[model samples]
Target: MRITALAAALVLVVASAAPASAAAADGTYEYKLLAKAKPDECFNGIGVPYPAGPPCAEGQPKVNQAYVWGLTRVGTDIWFGTGTNNNCLTTGATLGATKPVLNADYVCEYAESQMVKNDPKIPPEIGDVRPPEVWVYDSRSQRNTDLSAQIDKRSTDDKYRRDHTIGLRAAGNFKDVVLLAGPTAEGYVNVFAFDARSHRYLGSTTYTGYGNVRTFLQYDNALYLGVGVGVNGGDGGAVLRWTGSLKSPFSFDVVASLPVQAADLSAYDGRIAATSWPAEGSVNAPEKMAGVWISPLLADGLPGLTTEDAAGWKQVWNARQYEPDKVTAATYGMGGVASYGGYLWWGSMHVPMKATKVHQKVYPQDTDEAKQAQVKGTQRATSIFRGKNLGTPDQKIELVYGAVALPVYDGVTKTWSNKTTNYTPLFGKSGFDNPYNNYTWRMVVTDGKLFVGTMDWSYVVQDIVSGGSQVAAPDPVGYGGDLWMFTDPEQKATAVNTTGMGNYLNYGIRNMIVDGTGGLYLGMANPMNLRTDLTDDVPEGGWELIHLTKSCK
Candidate 1:
């Protein structure tokens, strides 16, 4: 569906304004629901008509979950990628011999059925792959185009094929070219580039060495890439510099090697700072742990952007300094990082069920009751932190949303050992005091204000294994993901919308970007595919795109 600017503005929802204060901005945010994933079109294969018949075989369940996986912007065109039935794919990827519980949420049919239908000889490591898509929405024309359709017809260039792409995880723009990338069935990262102005396919390439790619940072008028080189990003990480022409659109040169996977990157105080993911064996070593690291000063020359300055990076803070248990701390992955008000701000994240895995490994549980206890004991919320004068003797760091003491697990004693967090939050507890806010998904600083997007697990806490049992949970504080804003770090955060912008099923904000106008674009994540009864109160599952404009009083 296409919505004109005038029509979109007519349906805008003006959110409640913050409390009056000297530091507060006297205004409310007005948002418009621009688009939603079409249930019939999103899951259809390339060149296939809407409502494409039934599954290949009966009794074999169809993967139904769909959501926006990646998003970026060029000019007035918003480009995003989509994936379907991801929960099913994840189940197949994780469980080999172990069978998962029979849950309505997901079924690992990809390995047993879906793969053979596509290719019997495909590698098991990438057997769950599906055909993902790239789409571009022109803000000016208010028309959405599926770029994947054009690629599918390019029979001459096999590089443009989308048959094997599981999902596009990241989108970026460099030198007037828009790039979309995701993992393929061959266990490699495949990237496709298109002309930003013409919207024509340029080329595509697969990086076999990098198993995972996260974010793309544009700093000092140059583009830098962050990726993981080992299986599932468990070995090490590297930062790459783009050095390609139109002929070789996928060319990149290594800039730095990290002890583990690099997740996000930010520019601060004339240097680059990065957040990391723990390696397979780096949980106990402070120097090799997951934390914040800073690079040497990037001058106008090629020193910092080349391999010559790889050794000049320094680890300023680590997980060991925050959480007491090394294994649990390692399970706390790092999320969005950015520079705001002369300080570098970052936060920790809990990959769903990760802490439970760590707990079971540390203290071998023999029964279902013991396993449930481990899950309950390891449940944790994310914490936010900020630092100043990093890498200097006078450097200082403080918790922005953390506790003085947190529960920890001891492997040797096999008991819960609570430990001091070492610093108190300047604002309040982690997840803004809500334990279910597991991910600080994305953050952006605009107009002297910081906007934080979070993944709240409140809606599905009962459906998933997160609660550790089949017991009921209290009705959630509110359904959907949350959006919070901070006019000043010294003041409390104002809730922009805790009900996922009126859609109780929109679980999180996966991607957010400023429009360079007085507006922001949000890509929402909603994977509740089983709830297809639109006649009811619940909204249809999949993804939604919203445009929010700030209106001052």
Candidate 2:
């Protein structure tokens, strides 16, 4: 009887494992890892040994962790930009106040006191600076070319340096030119242009007015991008229309002005819509709250609108409309918006510990109750929201995955919010039943289905918050980011691949592009610099370009 029962358990185990590996074997989703960053690829010159001895400075062996920050496809060439050492950058920018000890494989260079002493003019909060690189891969010829040397050859005053242009975050094609943009350390935007046909670098430009940029959309014979206006991109936001000339690539006109930083932009129902980031400092009105906003009908079906068009824009929905507490509403920002299945679909984004840090600043965790309140205030995982006929009185919005009641900490009263969220989720709780899926990093529609990619924080759960206590790490059995597919709005999304394409170090799916055929190109976000042991079962972490090809059924 014991032997029979053991055989039955073995059969169950085989059945469970079959479906998990079926995607690769069944020819439905075959992933090919095309390119990856080398372990010792350094961006900046360092160390006193100069050219001969060591390539990098002491304690900075892992300073060049890069990611495919910007990706776009023109004709037969796929163009991508790499941003180096982002975790170190985030260490200074966000986590400097309460510097937490991350995993053993990662290091935060800017947090070191000696580094700050060397350059007292710059604070530790600004982070380490490293120049980004642009590359192109020809699908037809199967050749990859690094075009970063062109920018280096034309350097005049370090405008293209890491201090001026840190990383490329957005990429899109306008007319015959492919444009890539990134924010400077001083809070300004820099753009680089390339000739799409020749694959030649057409030089770069700096826009002093815009601080940060997110996504780009080409509609009605023109290209538009969402940008933030002031320091650290917190003051306000605007949507700028490209004038479509390589000679005047930097020239753009504001089509819509927003209350906060504009994030992802999408076109739906003959209009353009955008997600937003919460403004820095304080939130006051509904417009300032992070939410989805729609523009006026597209200037008579063309891109010739004036400032009058910007004025006609309206805030269709906001965080204030859903969250009962103002604090949670202000902290929540919308992420990854896309038009799918006759509706505008978007998800909420909560920067890990952003709310917790805010509450800590106000309440100081003086008592045990205040510390509990801080934990309660930490926002839940991302929730998907979709709306039809937005910006109209009769518009209907549905919650696809979210909590019925979102808890918030009121620092003023030093108590937790008793109110509940307005909408009940149709699918399930936020993050699709996994609380670690904090950011809806990328969303794309392909093959009559909607694909949603998430940033899973399970890998870093142990080091999320600072004060010496560690959160229990998630099980390593399922540690990678997630990709979900929705065939119908009424039905729950199916898991396409939950193991980050077989690399557990890949924490997020940063970018996705449809190949027009049955293939989809994915730009993976894996920034573990010190995990360079190639002999391991799963290879080292860095940026990787993966091609997912589906077999014709």
Q: Top TM-score: which candidate number? A: 2
- Write one digit per residue (lDDT tens) for candidate 2, span 269-376: 888899998886535687888888888887564554455677667888888887776655677878888899899999988776666656566557665444544554
Query: Could you tell me which residue pairs clash in candidate 2?
Result: none
* Prediction RMSDs, each to the true structure: 8.6, 7.6
lDDT of 1 by residue, 415-515 (tens): 66568988888888777766667788778888787888788765655454232233332343455677778888778788787767667667787778888
Candidate 1 CA-lDDT value? 0.69
Residue 155 Cα positional deviation in candidate 1, in Å, after optimal superposition = 3.7
What's the TM-score of each model vs. the native? 0.85, 0.87
Off by over 4 Å in 1: 1-27, 40-51, 54-65, 90-110, 121-129, 156-161, 367-369, 465-477
Which of the numbered candidates is closest to the native, going by highest lDDT? 2
Looking at candidate 1, the ten consecutive residues that score lowest on lDDT are 13-22
After superposition, the stretches of candidate 2 with alpha carbons farther than 4 Å from their true spots are 1-27, 41-63, 98-102, 111-123, 299-307, 410-413, 463-475
